[model samples]
Target: MQRVVEEISLKAWPAFETINHRGWLMRFANGYTKRANSVTVLDEIGLDIEEKITYCESQYRARKQNPIFCLLSFTNPEVLDERLATRGYQLIEPSLVMGITLSERSLNILPIINQETLNDWLVAYHKLKALAEQPSSTHHMILAGIQSEILFVSFKQNEEIVACGIGVLESGCLGIFDLVTSPMQRRRGYATAIIQGLLQWGIDKGAYFSYIQVVKANIPACNLYEKLGYEPIYEYWYRVGSNSGNEK
Candidate 1:
């Protein structure tokens, strides 16, 4: 299952690159390749492992200007992990890549948002932001960009924002990101409603497919996604490292 997940993750690299907001990239001797924000691998030939580590650390330090850094994978690259540990970096949590076919499921949630309810949407996002490892700036920026191209459907209870989701139209598919519900709002079907609302929006936009990513260890979330017809598409691991010493 792990290997299968890894392969699927590798397959989604292109889509991941297209949706990434940070514009992260990997520098090579010949040129630079766009880096996968949530997951990627270090593949450097000619240079020994140490040299590769040095290069990646340098790149990571340079990219830290954007705030938090993410190194995602499905398996442990011991060589890289050890090098990173020698520095000040620490391994964070693992993430899962879950996906579903739009045609396989039906969407029937009504969107309850309009220009007058924009503040409610922002409040909901802020509430969910507290649950993420990092702040929500990147997500906020992405949402801002997609507003013109996609529908931002949300759900509220008692006039309080509880759940929100976004659907982006790309290459005949709807890529769903930042589907979140507040801790206080769980177990009340708000998440399901939010996803359904987004799916309905996607269908309206002529999208034929949909997909999302979640952490592997988050069993409750995995169950929720599976219950909603999402299947395991891939898995990714996050490794952190710093540039303090050791050249390849």
Candidate 2:
């Protein structure tokens, strides 16, 4: 089950390009999400773990990224984990990968939204996340490059956008990303409405399951997702250092 969920995650946020290094997959997407930029090793490899780490570090350096990192889950090889620990890799950004089996729901195909809607979504995300004004180039490239069917759904109050989400449908599953609500408008049903809209699209496509990634410390999101039937299948934390990197 863990392996299956990890595979779904990889498919959901595939890198724009990838490199295979000694059984480890190095995904690069202009540093959009750590998942796309970090190393993922799901299978056992032939090289010594320390040597493999050295190789990955050199590769990321070539790409001008520091603090080489890896996506580590329980399904990853134990020997690799020990090697990273021995080398002083510290974990950060622990996150829960939650999933649910989709059921029927209400939805409209939601016409391909205009750029304004996309703008609103980014604003909400940046505000909630305390990021600077959203940069259109990197973020837009990441969002628009997804090959799976997707929709940008939002909730409006008095003609202003208050909540938004990105729904992706791939291989019988829907992966929800960037679900955000204006801080002032939260505690209303706006977030839930956006989720329902995305799920409905997935149900229409005959998807059997859905998944979302939330920071482990986010209590409100965990509560909401729990209410919606999503459960944490696995927990992963990034091991970060100048010598190594943590989960992305």
Q: List the global CA lDDT of all models.
A: 0.53, 0.73
Model 2 vs truth, CA RMSD: 4.0
**lDDT (Cα, tens digit) per residue for candidate 2, span 1-248:** 66676777777677777778777787777767777778788665446767778877777767776544666566555666667767777767888989988666544445332223556566656665656765556776777677778777767777776777888888888889888888778888777777777777789888888889888999999999998788987777665556234422
Q: Which residue pairs does candidate 1 place in steric collision?
A: 25-35, 50-248, 51-248, 73-237, 96-214, 96-215
Q: List the residue pairs that clash in candidate 2.
A: 68-245, 69-245, 238-246, 238-247, 239-245, 239-246
TM-score of candidate 1 relative to the true fold: 0.66
Q: Model 2 — which ten-residue stretch has the worst lDDT?
A: 107-116
